[model samples]
Target: MSTFRTASRVDGNQSTIVASLRRIGCTVLLTHQLKNCFDILVGYRGRTHLMEIKDPAQPPSKRKLTPGEEEFRRTWQGSPYHVVETIDQAISIVTAP
Candidate 1:
């Protein structure tokens, strides 16, 4: 049998990010429960985006991606993937033309 470690599910920054996206006329879907998947699925202006939300307080060098996320990044050929460290960045990505 293999052991599994549950990923920390609480992200203090997600609420702000979701609010910011919605305020800018984007639809945001929280996918935090989907392990290794992007944290959000966003739609705007007839386009979709996959976003992995990261804590800005965490240094980039210390951030690590799960095996599933790695595979998704390497193999998926759908919407653009983004790593957003702040609400501003998330909003900018979804709103950018």
Candidate 2:
């Protein structure tokens, strides 16, 4: 099984993202921890993908990434792990994985 998670200050965008993912046949898991951990989790073709979503208008902070997120990036270098800036970007990440 796969779990998809995202964080949003407002429920509108969050709900929209989750609904979009489901439309693409993804199972979305709305969580607080997974919000910062990763944007989404995708299980397809026997593989699992972890995603991170960020507002494009919002630049990446110099602050350190989470240990799990950092480890995920290192171990799955070739996979599609991205920081999404907009709804389009979020959809792109979900579709990529």
Global Cα lDDT for candidate 2? 0.55
List all candidate RMSDs to the true structure.
2.9, 6.2
Q: State the lDDT at 22 in candidate 2.
A: 72
TM-score per prediction, in order, is 0.83, 0.50
lDDT of each: 0.80, 0.55
Candidate topping lDDT = 1
Tens-digit per-residue lDDT, 29-57, candidate 2? 64425433565665544555565554444
Please identify model 2 stretches exceeding 4 Å from their true place: 1-13, 31-36, 44-47, 62-68, 76-79, 94-97
Best TM-score goes to which candidate?
1
